[model samples]
Target chain A: MKFLGVIIVCLTGGLLLYGTTDFPDWGDPSSPASTHLSDYYIEKTIEDTKVPNIVTSVLADYRGFDTMFETAVIFTAGLACFILLRDFRGKKERFYRHKPTGVVLHVKDGKKTLTVGKEFEHMDKDWVPSDLIIKTVCRILIPFIQIYAMYVVAHGDFSPGGGFQGGVIFGSSLILLAISYDLKTLVNRIKEKVLGIFAALGVLIFVGIAAICMPMGGNFLDYTALAPLVWDPHHVRALGMLGVEIGVGFAVMAVMAIIYINIVSEGRHDEGL
Target chain B: MHWPIDLIVLTFVIFCAIAAISVKDLLGTAILFGAYSFMMCLLWAVMGAVDVAFTEASVGAGVSTVFFVAAVFRTSRRTKD
Candidate 1:
């Protein structure tokens, strides 16, 4: 059976490589894609949307409907992860550590809970003393990483990064915090409810901006219709794109956090890596 | 110049892909998958698709690797097959 599977995989891979042989050469000027809308987008993206980055303008302005659905798809993925993995049942065993002397306490009862104070802290089953170097370095670096992420999101019109990339970077910073410390540190800082709300809010911001355009005498996602709302009407499209990018950034960041938290904790919202 | 760099990255990508699948240790596979993603990101950058390269670096190489590690932490490290 294994040999048959390997043969099938090899055949499929060969067929795929063979299929690529018939395609246009890389960056062929007269290829179908280059001859068609590529020219228009390259030439007129700046004039049309006031965004210098053609990719940003094309993604958020010219083909915004597609991007909107992409945000919805991300939101749906987070929702699906939440629905499938979230475990509401309490864990039967809980561990707490006394901060002063590092005395570990284990409670076996599922119903009874302890009131954690300064002396007592929640501990994971695989808890080890968090390294001072890792914690200190991450503490110092997280701010810069977060700042760079915001820059990527804000400067998408003039640069390579947009909301998705920026959001992922920001989410990874949060994940880094979890890795350096523990999952409890992250969960305590950002609540599960807050993450869910932000995820939904991000998608709402995108749809809301798009929907507002329709009532303002333009088609869906028409930034030109948003001219009246902003102070500088000439750069309204750029501003609109920025707004949409921010919305995407929020959604992606929250969803990344939600998925990480859920998976690491196995829906219990407690001790994890 | 570009072709040589591209060729090197593509070779690494293929190598990582094969190694990741064949590795019996799931932890090793997760790290190899990350190496595969980083190589793919380099290939995308070489092709002048900077935006795609950025996405691949952050989403593919950065966060997804952490996700895989977290998953491995929760489950068994050894694969049955």
Candidate 2:
């Protein structure tokens, strides 16, 4: 049966390779991607928005509607993680197998034998300390990564990096902290409550920007008419785009980290050491 | 037709995925799954799907590996040869 399964998998992989070969060429400037419905987003975005990331321009302004749902994607992921891993926060985790209430003998420092139970230390023997160099590097890199993510969010009118890429990059840096230090340390760094609040706030901010345009008798995401404070329509549009992008970056980063942490921590405690 | 770097990344992805499915050691299988994600990320980047590559690199290469390994932690990692 295993042999037959292997053969079937191989055939499926072969089909996938054959299909991908017919996909759009890598980095083809004239492909269907570069020629889209919105020419202004691609051609004049740099000069108008004062940003230099094309993908960002497309995501933040031209297609902000798609991005609203994208933030919800992250929010749903966060909710899923919370539902899967956490149980009443303050409650102590129970063992999968029935652990006896009696005391247990543990050896420490080779000379002293200790009996601990009921409320023993939560530390596990297999838990390894993070390397000094690695942890130091993670600490150093985090600020730089956040700066880059912000830059990407800020400059979506001239280049490739946009909200989604910036969000994932930001998420990875947080995961790095989790790996280099420990889950508990990350929990402290990014509190669950803060993540939930920020995610909802991001959506509200996006809607508020839309509401500003709605009263002016323009389309819901019309950036061209969002002027009055700034005479230049371009400036107001750019400002609105960036505001939404920042929100997306935060929501995605927070939610992905939440999911990763939940899965990791649950797996750890479930397997009694 | 002449993407040597892509060829290397694609080869790496294929090998890792194959090894992940084939390995008798469950722990090794989980680790190989991570390697598979990393290679897929690299491959996507080479193809200029930077966004797709970014998500894959973070969620697939980094987090998914941790998830699978954590799962193995609760169970015996030994597999019958």
Candidate 3:
């Protein structure tokens, strides 16, 4: 099997290297990739969409439907991870420890075998002591990271970031909190149900905007149709782009969190590494 | 390709990619893969595709590295490879 893999890799690499010879030189002005659609987009993006960032206008406005479906793809991935990993079967035996005299009690079923006591710790054998430095630093820095993520998402029209990048950044902050403190701490703050809703809601917002355009007289995802109710046609396209970006941001953020939580917990959210 | 810095980054990227696959420790492999991603990010930045570079830095070097570490944490660290 390994030999076959190596042979396949060698063949693929040889083909790719051969293919690269036909590609235009780096930064060639007359390259097909640079000449064909690039010229049109570079020249017309500002005039048509009123957005300075060509990538953003192209991704969110010119190809709004594609972005909407891309957001849906992320949403679907989150749903798939949730479905594949989530375990509904009964949990294993749990042990409870009394705090007063250091006594351990094991419970097999959910028959309320032990009476509730305020002085009892749940005997979290898997729990680890969070690092003081890590917890303190993450607590201080998470807000700033989140603010920067929001900034990236909002300023994507003029910057080098957009929904997908900003969303990943935002999701990373939550994951950082999880790593610094614990899975329980992060889960307590943001419930799985909320993440699921956000995932679906994000895609819904994207499709909803596009579908609204259809009813307003223009084709699907046509932002010009929105001008009658809001702003100039050019500005409407920019606004539509912003709305699409926000939808993509929400979808990507939820999906990243969902995938992380599911993978960490092995589909059972009872405890995580 | 810009010769000096780009070549340096490309060399480091290849080294890291090879090292990542060769490492016996799964955790070490994951970290090396993250380094490879950072190098790729630098290559894209040098190529002037700032949007692609930004996405690679955030996704490849940032979130992907975190995911790799988390996966490594959940799984066994030792590997036959």
Worst 10 residues of 2 chain A by lDDT: A90-99
Candidate 1 — which residues are off by over 4 angstroms?
A: none
For every model in order, the TM-score on chain A comes to 0.98, 0.71, 0.88
Better of 1 and 2 by lDDT: 1
Q: For residues A1-273, what per-residue lDDT tens digits would candidate 2 score against the true structure?
A: 989988998899899989999877855666676577446665787776666666666677777788777777778878877787765433233211113542333334444433334554333345554589988998999889878877765664445555656776777777777777766567767787886777677667777777778787778978666786455665787777876777777777777676666666662322121
- Where does candidate 3 clash, by residue pair? none
* Candidate 2: CAPRI quality band: acceptable
Against the true two-chain complex, what DockQ does each candidate achieve?
0.89, 0.39, 0.77
Per-candidate TM-scores read 0.98, 0.73, 0.91
Docking class of 1: high
Shift of residue A34 alpha carbon in model 3, Å? 2.8
Instruction: Put the candidates in DockQ order, highest first.
Output: 1, 3, 2
| Candidate lDDT (C-alpha), each | 0.93, 0.69, 0.84
Clash totals for all models, in order?
Answer: 0, 7, 0
Q: Compare candidates 1 and 2 on DockQ and give the better one.
A: 1
- In candidate 1, position B63 carries an lDDT of 89
